[model samples]
Target: MVDFTFNAKEQEIIREIRREGLVLRKYARYYDEHEEELPPDEFPEAKEFAHIDKMAADRGADATSPTAFYMCMLMHRTWGDMMRMKVPFTALGNASVTAAGTDEQKKRWAKTRLSMANTEPGCGSDSKAIETTAELDGDEWVLNGEKIFVTTGIRAEGSVIWATIDKSAGRGGIKAFVVMKGTPGFELVKKEKKMGIRSSDTAAFVLKNCRVPKENLLGMDPTVKKGGGGFKGLMKTFNLTRPGVAAMGIGNIMACQEFVAEEMAKEGVAVDYEAGQHKRSAIQQKMIELEAELEAATLCTLRAGWLADKGKPNNLEASVSKQKGGDISRRGAQLALEILGAMGSTHDQLVEKWFRDARITDIYEGTGEIQRLVIARELLNYTSKDLT
Candidate 1:
């Protein structure tokens, strides 16, 4: 029930990003018409905060609320949708450095944004089931396997890959590594033509005997005989990034609400705008519910981010927020599309794209099913090893 009070500066920042969103929307249409118009990188101011250490410190020092930091990142990413395919990789890379990388690793990757190409073919949702192998060879680790559905894999300056060091040990055996671009055996094998968020790149990577250094190991925890370290570190990254994904869902919901409201207005629908009186249009009613749900989900996301920033555990809340946000996003988009009728199906209207974009929210970060599983696991006092 808590509301975020955006001061004048924050309000201006939000308005600027929304205005920028309009520009990105135009470019999205351009990309739809001419695929080549999509660029590998379209620089945005968000890149300036790509360094997690400083950004984290600044947030802490300024006594800025976690809600503000999350909001800033959300706005930055949303505006970066001008080059969606590129920004995701940058964000992923930035996240990896903060969550898993060593001080040295962080410094080295500080300047360049990297993408996480973790999921692979047949891997489904189990990151521990990854087939990518990283075998120690003298001073270096040799990696070999194919990574599928890597967001930004095609154009990443570098990648943080989650692969198994020992398949026999299962999930615990997984480890993450920082793989720089142009590593001899690391190649972008394919890029998926996505249904929505077309501007964002989704790619597959083929690592054939790719050599990465021992120094590239990310987890601060030392590997144990019980297969510790890797997946735990990856989960930390997820805890932080998943909320950002949820925020994206919230953004999609906001877009849907806006579309639905406009459509209702065009039809000469009128509803009370008073503080206590609820709106009456079917679509408007749905929007109101979605907005309330989004507000709650947004709070969860901000709390998760706050916990992460404070180094507190928040597995349950994070999953709940993601699940709620993703579900609301899909529903809000569906409602918007239904209100728009046939026009919703057309590419000319952004509602169709919003619906498509909302679907990805449910699938990525963690599937709604996966989020439920995680929530239940946490509620039941289950450990990572128990479910995996």
Candidate 2:
């Protein structure tokens, strides 16, 4: 019951995923070079692959739960291209709705492509400093503020914006509002030129007296409690999402590791686990260390997901996973480049692209510094006020 090994059916699915990944790998470089071009929804080879339903139907009755298997698939699938295939059109706001919205709100917005806006010109990781304001106006809530670095803002049907009703109340007054695209005063300011993950659309937004129905307020809670109930509720979504972010990083790192290992093997520099660390060459020892770190980060990520699947609180574990995953990704990419020498920096290879992509892992979804702060406060039994 506690086994981590993939069964026959899961292995089959993974094989299928790998088969498809090979095709997607062909376009990775093209998209990386032409950041404005979007990948096609369906490739020529897409028809040959089994759909999700078919894959599910193929599962053996005695097979272990697919959660861990799926996580592994995520890593393998992304390994080919250093990016997740954007097949499903879900967004971060979808998770927010699932986590905090009322039943009616969930039913209405769950399927909509929704981006999340949290960062502002002045605030990035310090979300509590968000200056966006929301005022209740008879039948609607008028919002006014500028949000920067809104992922998918250009393409999403709407956005889940974090704005405060009472800035004086601190976190307690902060709330999420579902502002649909084409809202009169909500404007797409411009797309951001990012260092990596260029294929993914990142845009800035200007909300000037943008009004949405009062019912659009997430959880439909207007009260700003002293305990910061609204803010806490919104943050609960991150307990699961942080681990997902870590998984993305792990996937990208795994891609770099696999690429390096393959290239090294061709040069007769294969990793030898049978040899002692002292007996192995410097390169071999470094590879072994990197592999160990990768395993540690992977295990931490899986533990966080497992806890969440079991309906257990994973706030601390999620932070741990994110911190480990982000650091590993950044370092792993650098090590990969070092191993490949100047060849790694060439655009002809994916190593450089991965290196650029990995840099964002430590910066987004809360920076590595922020994650450490969370872990420290949790471990020391200190509140945000006590530590920060």
Candidate 3:
């Protein structure tokens, strides 16, 4: 029988994660203000909670199910801070490697920390317009270009960089290459000062004739096919990642909701869900509306993740989740601040920081506009060229 309620084991895991989140919240303000302090990999307080894997193993959870409990844990973690606690071994480039790398390539790069480089000065949402070039030079591939807004570039051991082998072929010629840090010509140009998620490192890099072994070419096929096979293969990584990105936005929205609810309750104003919308106060009605939107966006993200876990195609669903999550987060944050009055705009409270952090969700992992384009293309059964 299908069960929607959490089992005892799942409840225990949730409780533990929430407890860890409370501990992590203590540092959220400090990091937001300092922006230079990196949170330690494992806090002393984290030792009290059972390791997440061990908890799952104890419960004998099905590893292949479409129901992603990990998404819940991520939501809870991000509830404390949008940057969350950075765990090792998981990076954006890891998704690229899993989607496009060969078995040998995966094993070889397993221990290396990797960041993804896709955006350039001229290219943001339109990835096909990337100007980075990768030229074959005998046994080496020479990379030359600049990449901006790399998420973990400051500390990552290597990067999965997108570059075109032939500019005339557009995305068909785009290929991902693994370039380790400390490569002779590769340089970390500068770390960007960001408006939000300040705890996380953002960097810009320059590659001037950066050379790596030909084997470093991801997927091992350098040929530009007629239908953009290379581009599609790389983009498949988004099928899994877009949902996670949406979940992060949902997390931020939930955090803001919880904060507003607590502050309102203190002022003797409460959200009575049983009451009709016409009877409730304006604040109550607004809170209810935000709650409904959050639920809808959360459901979209869960559906997309579930489809991916089931090994089903989820391109349309992923875009839907990203689009909704991004819009909802931005709106939710703005509403939460509006409801709080002038206090919400003050740096003394984390709600203001959340408002700043929430803006990035709609901009990254493909902008909301780009996701809308993808959704429209899918629904109309048209190619990107046919619609855009």
Q: Model 2 reaches what TM-score against the true structure?
A: 0.95
Q: Report the backbone clash tally of model 2.
A: 0
Candidate 1: regions farther than 4 A off = 1-3, 33-37, 43-63, 72-89, 220-222, 225-227, 273-281, 384-388
Per-model TM values vs. the true structure:
0.86, 0.95, 0.96
Q: Candidates 1 and 3: which is better by TM-score?
A: 3
lDDT of 3 at 132: 98
Ranking by TM-score: 3, 2, 1
Scored by lDDT, the top model is: 3
Q: List the residue pairs that clash in candidate 3.
A: none
Ranking by lDDT: 3, 2, 1
lDDT (Cα, 0-100) at 297 in candidate 1: 77
Q: What global local distance difference test value does model 2 have?
A: 0.84
lDDT of each: 0.71, 0.84, 0.86
lDDT string for model 2 (1-388, tens) is: 3455667877887777777877877877877888776665465676777474388456787654454555566666767665644454778888888888999999998679999999999988888898999999999999999999988887789999999999999999999999999999999989888788877789899999899999999999899868788898888878867877777788888888888899999999998899887889888887888899999988887777777777778889989998998999899999999998998999988889989988887888899999999999999999999998
Pairs that collide, model 1? 85-200, 85-201
Q: Cα deviation of 263 in candidate 3 (Å)?
A: 1.1
